[model samples]
Target chain A: MIEFKNVSKVYPNGVKALNNINLFIDKGEFLVIIGLSGAGKSTLLRLINQLIPVSTGQVIVDGVRMDTASGKILRNMRRKIGMIFQSFNIVKRMSVLSNVLSGRVGYHPTWRNVLGIYPEDDKQIAYKALQRVDILEKVHNRASDLSGGQQQRVAIARALAQQPLIMLADEPVASLDPITTVQVMDFLKEICASDGITTVANLHHVDLAWKYATRVVGVRAGEIVYDQRPSQTTKNQFIKDMEIVYGRPIHHDEFVIEEAVV
Target chain B: MSDRIIVPPPKRLGQTLGILTVILVIVASAIFARFNIIEVILGLQRGGRILARMFPLPGWFGPLMETLQMAVTGTFWGALLAFPIAILSARNIVDVPWIRVPLRFFLNILRTIPAMVFAAMFVAIFGIGNFSGVIALVIFSFGLVAKLLFESIEAIDEGQVEALRSLGADTLTVIRYAVLPQILPQYISYTLYAFEINVRSAAVLGYVGAGGIGQLFERALAWRRFHEVGELVIVSFVVVLFLDFFSAKVRRSLI
Candidate 1:
């Protein structure tokens, strides 16, 4: 379980990126945080791994307070939490398999990893992760050579190799086209379900969040405005609640009518 | 779109002040040294007489070949030692402050000392041979190559390093697979650049009794054999130019 108790973040420049956030995410939950740009969705996701530290309160993951964790304890905590970036962040020069294998670095000693002397079992784990994402065939190909969608899948494979208990995706599909977006989102949802990993994703598209998310958390100006399950959410009420997050009424042009119709 | 805009040109106060300070210092130094343009003109007449004595060339292939050998040996040793030092000095590769800071400071100190001084120091220790020249060139090249390479390393796309870090690859693996391939071309270019510089510096190492073409020039001049000195100068100049051109071509291709 991941719990946020009055967790807040004030940047060095004094921008309040997160404001008194109190939330709990259970295992195997597909939670999507949605808001307009600068609403602290990314900041909130980063705080769970302490990629950005919180200014106040505590973030507890599996009963360990992240704010107080340091050195080895911090690294151990990070090992169990996988992060996916919108840019994929795969080393372009490395082969797809090597990129995936890198997710296993925290598990080995520094010297072994430095020498690329990963054990056979680690290689097996990497291959299995690639297989899970159905990109095992491109394992030997350079990451830059892959298509955008394929590269995103490779990134997912890398995250899976970590055997993470929690996965945090910061706008994972923002850079992808609509078709690829669904494909990537479906993969994320599937992995979350199959692996029983609690998944937190920051999404821009309201329809995409509604389709893939079991629960939606809306943020506005660094504050959580609404938190609701999809089953309990109505289209009109969702749009109405989104105003507090977007600071304006949901524009008709912004909605993908085909998805809403479906 | 402007509504009665009052635009003032950017102030030139800094540039004007800098130029004025430079002029003032130069004027003050010239006055203190009793500057005389007439003295320089008279010295040129004496230079004409010295130039007249260097007409006939002496045939000495042995000394010429020895100089070439010295330059080649010095350049090779210098470039060889620079490789690891350059890699260690790169900020992205060596994150430890204890290692990086000291290595950077040492490289700076090496660069601050002139190649001539290094040659003189080595000649004092090793005693009048190509060995001293080669050691000087090696140290000199290490300073030059390491500075260029570490700067190149610092400028590399850090995204690649971060990606490697995420994979859990050790620092060395990241450097070998990600960092090394990208910087290899530039590294070779820097080595060639260092070699070019070393060849020029090595020729003069013999002035301090470290063997090279400069030794032949020194011997001929001491004995008042202007013809032999002229021959050594011409040959060394041609060799330096040839090496410079060849290294430039190679660097152009590598980069």
Candidate 2:
């Protein structure tokens, strides 16, 4: 579980990315954050791990205060949190297995990692992670050689290899095609759900959010504007309520309706 | 539209002034250096006669081999030392401006001093031999390779590093997993490039008594053995050409 108390973030050039805010994410919940670009959605997700420091608040993740933690404590806290990016940020030149094994770096000493000596159990973990994402065949292939969707799957496997308690996805499928987007989102949701891992994903597609998220939160101008459970609201009502989040009527293109079946 | 004719645009005053400055500098420098077409034409015939006498190459594999050895050794040691320094100098890797700025300045100073000058200084300290030349080449290769490598490091995709950090990878682990893999090919390519340059400079470091075939070259010239000088030039040319071709092939394969 993660909690943000009176959290605010201002960039060095004085852009207030997040205003005085509060948010809490419970364990094993697939929470989707919906917002326009630059609406502090990313800032909020990153704050949970203290990737970006909070200006004036406490970020407590599973009990430890992330903003004040340093050195071994910070690293120990971070090891339990995995993050993925829209760009599929696996090392392109490295093999898929190596990229996945990078997830275990936090568990070992620097010299052991440098020499690439992972334990036999760690190797099994990496392989199982790859298998979970259905990318086991490409384990020996270079990461760059994979297609966009496969690359994203490899990134997911990398995160899973960490055996993380929480996974943060920043626009995880923003670069994938429609069908691939659904496939990737399905894998992410299914794996995290089965593992009882908390997942916070930033999604541009409203319909996808409706389909996957247990709870959906909307952000605007560095503030949370809407929060809902799709189970409690009708699909039509959810679409209608999103107008307050977008500051305008929801466009048909924002729904991702055509890709729903896939 | 078909009947319309476009006129040439007039040049801006600044452009005209820049061109004029270039021409002025060229003419002034040529005059100061006493540029004489007739004298150059006359000198060419003398140069041709000397070239003709220098034909029928002499055997001197020992010094040529020594020259190559110096380049190989120097480049190896220089690139070895450059790795850590380059990591420290990269802006993305080391965010502290105080550390990075001074490291950059030190590398700049290293590069500013020519290999020949470094050879001269080392020769003064260590005495004349291939040791001094190797030291010179080491310093030179370090500057060139480190500068090129750090720039490449700074330009790599930051997202990969971010991913590593989010997984709780320490700085060294991040570098080994994320930073090094992305930059390895370019780093090796740069080191090979430095080796190529070192070969040429190593052959000439003997002018400052730094050692290698350059000392032999100086001896040949001093003794008026033009044919041996010609032989050295031809051999050095062949070796340099082979290395350039081989290293280029290797570098291409890396990418």
Q: Which candidate tops DockQ?
A: 2
What value does the lDDT take at residue B206 in candidate 1?
A: 81
- Provide the overall lDDT of each model, using Cα atoms, as 2-decimal numbers: 0.80, 0.90
Name every residue pair that clashes in candidate 2: none
Docking class of 2: acceptable
Which fraction of the native contacts appears in each prediction? 0.27, 0.79
Query: Every model's DockQ, to 2 decimals?
Result: 0.12, 0.29
- What TM-score should be assigned to candidate 2? 0.87
lDDT of 1 by residue, A41-146 (tens): 9889878888678899999999999888876677778778888888887777677877888788778777776676777677788877887788777877878999
Candidate 1 chain A: 10-residue stretch with minimal lDDT: A253-262
Per-residue lDDT over B1-255 for candidate 1, one digit per residue giving the tens place of the 0 to 100 score = 222222222346668888999999998998899997688878988887787577633445665666667666766776677767777877777667788889999989999999899989988998988888878887888788888888898898775665554444455766765687678889888888887887788777788988867787788889999987777778888888998999999999997
Listed in order, each prediction's TM-score against the native is 0.75, 0.87
Q: Report the lDDT of model 2 for residue A120.
A: 70
Please identify model 2 stretches exceeding 4 Å from their true place: A259-262, B1-59
Off by over 4 Å in 1: A255-262, B1-113, B125-127, B156-185, B211-217, B220-255
